[model samples]
Target chain A: MSRDENAAGRTMLEVDRLAKRLGEFSISNVSFTIDEGEYFVLLGASGTGKTVLLETLTGVIQPDSGRVVLAGRDITRERMQRRKLGIVFQDQALFPHMSVGRNIAYGPASSGMKRSDIEKLVESLASGMGIGHLLDRGPATLSSGEAQRSALARALAMGPDCLLLDEPLSSLDSGARVEIRTLLKKLNRGGMTMLHVTHDYEEAVALATKIGIMENGTVVQVDTPQRILTHPGSEFVARFVGIRNVYRGRLRRESDGTSLFESGSEAPFRLETLCEAIEGEATAVVRSEDVTLSAYRPDTSARNLFEGTVSEIVPARRGAEVTIDAGAMIVAMVTERSVEALGLERGNRVFASIKASAVRIIEG
Target chain B: MIISRIEPMHLIFAALGGALLLFIVAPLAGMFLNVGKAELSEAAADPEVTGSIRLTLLSSMGATLIAAIGAVPFAWILARKDFPFKRLVNGIVDLPIVIPHSAAGIALLGVLAPGTPVGSLGERLGVTFIGGIAGIMAAMAFVSIPFLVNAARDGFAAVPVRLEQAALNLGASPLRVFLTISVPMAWRSIISGLVLMWARGMSEFGAVLIIAYHPMITPVLIYERFGAFGLKYARPVTVLFVAVCLVFFLALRMIAGRRSHVEG
Candidate 1:
């Protein structure tokens, strides 16, 4: 089944409140679900419990609490071999002593498959992974990409129910990273349920159908990549998803059913927002691309408009990021064409326009 | 090639290292040079000498085979596990290597000799240990098993734990993982350890002499000849034994090295 077909499909792997403590780092109350064919990416930074969570799911590190249900079966305390979850580690961890063929055959052979069947299986897996010719070669002789392919084929030899990937692209060059990424996408499209953990947000955004953002061992938010980028659930998630302008302040509910976000203490400013939060401390996330900048207060119905001086204009990939210092600091992304047309520079007065709907408020 | 300038300090260090090397080689070279072809042939032809050499080889091989059955697993445990007093267990494994072989022999005798608990148990089982072939093997194993354990442990420790995990994830049982991944990856060190253990066992004299005086091994025979006769009588036998050991050691090393290359 394709990812779209499995969007509301059966849950292949359900990790509910899984908790584990390894030395000082801990994974606490982590929960998520992967559909039969959905590619789930657990995105977190270094020192987050991504690795620990993967280990717990793979049955390497037993969790202190919670259930890991695979295909409606509780596998929280199951043996790693019986869990039927194939894992590709960060290092790829191929058997150095075995040829690519033997490495791929290892899983099938272990489960008492016939010699002919194992040979056929190994051959098919090698050809499928584009490593058919490399089957006769040893792991040490293969390139990083080839080794990774061999590792993947070896993991898939047993036809696991779910594949777990731990930073599969962290060690690869950019070219190999893209190659493996395409391969992973192809594999997932072929009805393989995958739970890939990575610290790179770009990888998560590019590959994940749904991303779980982890913080301090707990999954803070689980949403689609677009939703995470457009409307982050927390300040950490906002900053992690590359939202440049984030402010922690108080949200006051107006009688008119609009919420006003008040930020900064010394030079406090309020931006009218359209969130359901009534009144409390909140985090206001305004995407840099959502904020428009002009030389003067142009005619517009933008609810949150302010006149400020452009304090910094740094060149970004798509355009220039213009940071303006009004009563509250605001960052806007203006293209190079706009920068030239508006004669935008440092210490220049400009009007930044943001609609009330552009402001997303999350409880702080 | 690039020629780098050498200083007086380099010369001094090189001379010291050369002296150490010369010290190790001088005695072996002198023995090889002193032995006459006629005398060497005579020693090799002697039934007593040949029988002793055969006995030594067989006993050492038997000891190595028996020790490896236990040592390899123990070594793997030592390599992979983290428990209380692990260092103490490691120290005890190496104790046989550090202690005097004669003292080791006496310790073995105390356990395996008649009237002791193990000795009485062996007596009940009709397995004589003292002054028997079993006693010789016991002595050899007591003094030489450490080499195998230490080498095998080093080999196992070098293997990344992730490979084992990867194998386990592939639905291999723990035993299958050990046999398929751990054993093959650590095969080189294990072979090297077995060879070292066998070589050490073959060269054991004081321990074997203390335990089994009858069915003399090559080392005990050499000592006997040296004590009964003189240097001239002992030199030929010693030279022949060394040559045999050198041949076997080199052959084993070449085989093990070639196999590891093939495996890699």
Candidate 2:
């Protein structure tokens, strides 16, 4: 592949077919390349080998097979101290015995940098992390957010070419989560390359430039965040990314230049969709937010409408999730105000409408 | 002010516990109270008594320092690694603590006698284990090393592994990680272990008596005085030794406690 194909410059790290077996859970034949200045996020559920992969990349856990190339050098055999890759763990893992300044300065001190230079670097990095005032405090005294920032500062003090973060914001409260998310975005804007792993889809949406969906032990899909959300490549990817209405169907071309999707053989719920692919088995998905709920049907341009009873109304953040059993299970996310206006409740008859363009087709 | 919080059961338990405490404190207090200032001064001025006390302190310190150099690393390994028969190695470390000190002395002699490999090799280097300071240290260390090893091991185990891994990722070599992170984090436990080992070695009687009686450490000197001159002469020396030990032990413990507090 040409180096310029990546949005950033040359690739900063290339993990080729890395494999490691740790008892029963093993990551096998995993490969990905992170370009310079690109914020690549590996999105996966827990127990999917995300942290193991990150540990392998950092040389904390050696891979059984494959090469780890960093900045044009093959460092598969290098020791963790020689690899120059910085990592922030989920728990922050700050040195409890050291003051915040000394913790940040640990990396440079280990490299035998002069004390004056180390202090200057620690100060600069701490200020950049917005934690300069916390320098004299011990790590145990800091809050979770402060500890995370200190960990990040410590990692950055080494001047690593690429930073590997494992769920950097998973342990923070929602407020701190947003703060750190903005901080990460600002860091990326300053031309820092990062490879972050997280399970939260919202976090991936907020921070990732490129997303790699992992399952079991392998990368199932790698694409831009927009594409991963709009067009998931697999059934697992579709369900994992919160595309709520995924159905296996057969697509057939109609004479009027559109396609008809027939879902099941028994009742055969059919819907009109926009697709140019030849007739074949496929999967259709629609985001829950795209499904609109109404108390009564009215004249509209939407192509698919079904009458069903509300099976569940679960309150969510800023909205309620309405599940309707319209011959097929469908979920719609509506704001609390909308729910109140429509007088929605369980067992209430409702109409679920979807535009033809909102239906996404994935080939089987 | 404090009596209002004390319940009837609390008073009963407190009386029982205080009685036990008095049982331990009354003897030591009586020994000191019985010794007149003149007798104390005389005992302090005695060359043999002072020499034996100095020898006891120095040799025990030597034994603790020497044992720690080997024991600390062994403790770290035991804490961090998972080798086959690790339990067996751990059991062997605790064996000295469980076995009688006289049995420990016999075991040491079995290996360090004149014709034995260790003893002859040492003799070639102009060192002997029997009736020498080295023998005293060996016996003292043999019985006291378990304290250091066990305490340091617990200390190292309490240090989170992620902290060490974080240091390694920050470009520290394994040795540097151990020295900067592991050792410093476990400093309290290691210091406690050293104090325990030093104190245990200082009071050792059976092992040192059988191994090297001639060195005349304070314990041996006390025994000789008790047997040769009865309680009259031994009481003053015992009071002097106990007083010195209490001062140093309290000072060392205070240092350890204050250091931990400051670091925390």
Candidate 3:
């Protein structure tokens, strides 16, 4: 809902309600904008219109509906040639017939630059992308990280209005993924307006200034990564951001005027909720990380505490996520060191407590 | 688990191809062995034989040029488009390849000999296919059309459509993309096709024999000499043609290697 399209210059790219169909798959009613020098990320699962959205921006595809406005000009009708948007495909799609220098120079040549200027620009970009050593080499000889950087260099050399990348790091190993992602960050830092798309939640959280979550071709929510993850408007957005604890529950007005909620657990839990309890029941949700794991009862004014067994530990990069089995399922994160310190293991009894403030209630 | 001995199928295929190779190569060996210095000198000394060779090269080049021009566009279309009766059109393009060379010759004669509207129109345009260079080119182009078109089509097909889309996104016109990306990417295939079309056109005989026997291309000359003076006299020209073709074939192979290296 927050649109800051007006910068010192005109809007770089504005997509208005774009719709496209191929086979039974349809991408409909999609609209978004990326301002000058803004880093916008489209995050979704595979086949969720991320690539189609990028293509629609690049003019490789003509949407069945909607107009694409770039720099205050309607580019929906412009041929792909005239649109001048650069894209890095998931597959590098490098021109195998061309050497790295020639590949980078392709864009400048198409832009009608002089040959010497193109050569000079290519040299500069190659150096900047750290591929100057490979300028004479073929694209096949480059590693995935190197190829992605070359792709980035090729797109940048074209002097595009904006960059559209379709999950450029998805194919790479973790190390390569980190490397390409850093390169993308550097591009954004140096004033390249980019629409980077990915299916990875953490990658979007790391690289995006603004993130849009799309489902079935419609963008359901667009916000900062924290807002989408912590305060998701719907169960769909919450689950998509990997929040593991969402419960359909009934809210009862207790004697003290506090809300008591039972989520099909053995006992009802109490929480402060803004949603009216006049409706017999509502939805209660909590993020997995919002629940804190402890060896004993967490003594706090904070609301809910439950005794449970440490059921499983799912390994993650930053730490191990502890899944505790109470009357209701609960998840909490503890560092691997903490897991050891607390002697947390499967079937070992533990206590989990979630702050009342962290509990979110939704009316559906 | 390796069976080193030749399998029955292998032996059968080897025998079949060996017999075919023998049929093709024995005559070359026999023809050269039979021709002495006098036969060679006589074949070389004859002004008509040299003239026929020269005319054959010139018109073969002409036919290749025409085929290249037509085949590039036809190949692009065939590689890119889908339409009703597409397979039939593809089959038509390939017809000359399977038709007996003499059958091709009769077909060319039927189409281009001064009777049909095409032949009359050609006459009106001051083009004659009988007893002239024009007739040799027509026959050669007819037989070689499939070779060029099919090769170039495969080349174009080998290029990903995404590359063209990428070029277009980078702001090159459709024509520019074809010239800059599509054609260049497939240039190896196109060149191979051109070479094939050229060689097939160069060796055209039965078709040329039927349509224009008087303007003697090397093949027609070879046939005439074989009929008139027997094997010894025709042998020198046959060996000369083989040498010329070998030189070009080797050159083509080298160029292909160089291109692969460059692409790599």
Candidate 4:
């Protein structure tokens, strides 16, 4: 590839096949991008290199093999200070020596803004962050929520091209976390392109426009919130997305080109398979909402009816969750109305119905 | 989880610590008790004592200024970078603080005395150490440097690198972040370190004694009075000097403490 074309190919922020080996544990061959104003969330468990990727983007740790392009410019060789990225750390690092006013004024003043303008901007930002009264107060006096707000306001005061948050809410209590998450969502709506790293699935669902699920050293799947939760690309994604009935089976394509997945065990329910699997051992991801319980076998040509005893009935969001042991674990999300109508109880026998299209197949 | 107020053990420790404090405070009491108005007037008229006090303040303050300027960059490196020989550098900072003051004095003399390479090299630059003001400053600086570096290092380290990165992301340069976020957040430690370094420089004796005996600082002056004349000759000066340093330290502490508490 010619250098110009390759350079043009770089997105607003493109990480080209990045890899960093630090002793035994390292990230490799990870690549992704963010647009000028996209809310990209890199979500993963602790120690999965999510923060590592964010740091690499910020030039904290230089990647060994990948190029980082920002706004169509090759910033691979650029120092961290030149990146013009705003970041909020987990601890809400505030300057102890500077008051709220001075802290907000810091970036603009240092960036060569006029002193009078900086003062005005500082006052406006302090009030905008709900700390106008505390402008004269020092950072050490602020509460955790207040401190995080100040940290965020200070970062935003610089008017960065891109913003990064390293688990800003990870350290807060539940109430503070919710408050911050809402604040972040509000900021995101106002055109702040952000790369937020978090280990919470709920947080990811709440704040992310697009989700990047990282495992080990690579992004296993990057998808919209609905796609990742409902149609995960791999078993790893399915498990993390809380899919209860994941059936590992073999694909049996018939002469008519119709596909059926023959799962292992004596009472495997036969159903038409929607997507072909990579290997003979295919996987199916089924969310609780996709499954339904039947008192008797219904008339359907799909051939996916199974008799199993109700194992457990539990509560979910505005609904009741019923677990049916139909050869495989079938978690059905029934509204409280249906739960009452069915009079569902543990050890009661019922037929479970799930259409093939509802089953998202993953190739091994 | 156990959220009771200060425990009995804490009270006991505080009482014992208070007694130990009195042990240190008793000398000041004696200095006040022994001093008459006549002695204070006589000591005030002694030009040698005044000159020594003036020189001591100048050299100590000068040493603190050197530490203040030199430590910022080095402290940032020590706080942020991971490199070979870092621990060795940190250990080097602790050497003068831990070693006997006389050893540090001798070390400074060996390096800065005329005929030594450093001494002759500095002399070529129109600077001399032996019996000179530069030697006094060097001795004081060598003894007090650790406080500055340590305080500054801890201050910078306490600042999350993420804040600086955030500043950079916002298009501010690295220097901008250091000046804006990192330095301000860490300023208390730096200021406290300066106070400590300045006070240490003021009290420095052994190191100053070996390098520049002629430019007598207050401590050395006190030693001279005790040997040549006696306590009656030195007690008044000692009381006055201690009182001045006490006021300085107390004021600086209150300001730094208030500022930090407000920020935090």
Which residue pairs clash within candidate 3?
A: A81-B171, B105-B207
Decoy 2 TM-score against native:
0.80
Candidate 2, residues A1-364, lDDT tens digits: the string is 3466656378998888889999878898888888889999999999999988988888878899998999989988899998878998889999887899999999999999999999999999999999999999998998888888999999999989899889999899867876787788888889889999999876776678899999999888989875787567986897799777767678988889998888965766777889665577666777899999999995779999999999999887769889999988888989999999999989999999999888877643
Off by over 4 Å in 4: A1-10, A23-25, A35-37, A94-105, A114-157, A168-192, A206-209, A243-292, A295-364, B1-22, B98-100, B120-128
Q: Each model's number of backbone clashes? A: 0, 0, 2, 12
Instruction: Give one digit per residue, the lDDT tens place, for model 1 in B189-253.
Output: 99999999999999998888889998888898888999999899999999999999999999999
Worst 10 residues of 4 chain B by lDDT: B162-171
- Per-residue CA lDDT of model 4 for B56-160, tens digit only, reads 988899988976788887899899999999989999999998999999998878888788899999999988788889889999999999989999999899887
State the lDDT of candidate 3 residue by residue for A199-238, as single tens digits: 9776777678788898888787888765676557666776
Reference-based lDDT, residue B164, model 2: 94
Q: Which candidate number has the best TM-score?
A: 1
Q: What TM-score is obtained for chain B in each of the predicted models?
A: 0.97, 0.95, 0.87, 0.91
Q: Give every collision pair in model 1.
A: none
Output the better candidate (1/4) by TM-score. Answer: 1
Docking outcome class, model 1: medium
lDDT: the better of candidates 1 and 4: 1
Cα lDDT, all candidates: 0.89, 0.89, 0.81, 0.80
Cα lDDT for residue A117, model 1? Answer: 97
**Order of candidate numbers by DockQ, starting with the best:** 1, 2, 3, 4
- All candidates' TM-scores? 0.82, 0.80, 0.78, 0.73
Instruction: Please identify model 3 stretches exceeding 4 Å from their true place.
Output: A1-10, A244-364, B1-20, B100-127
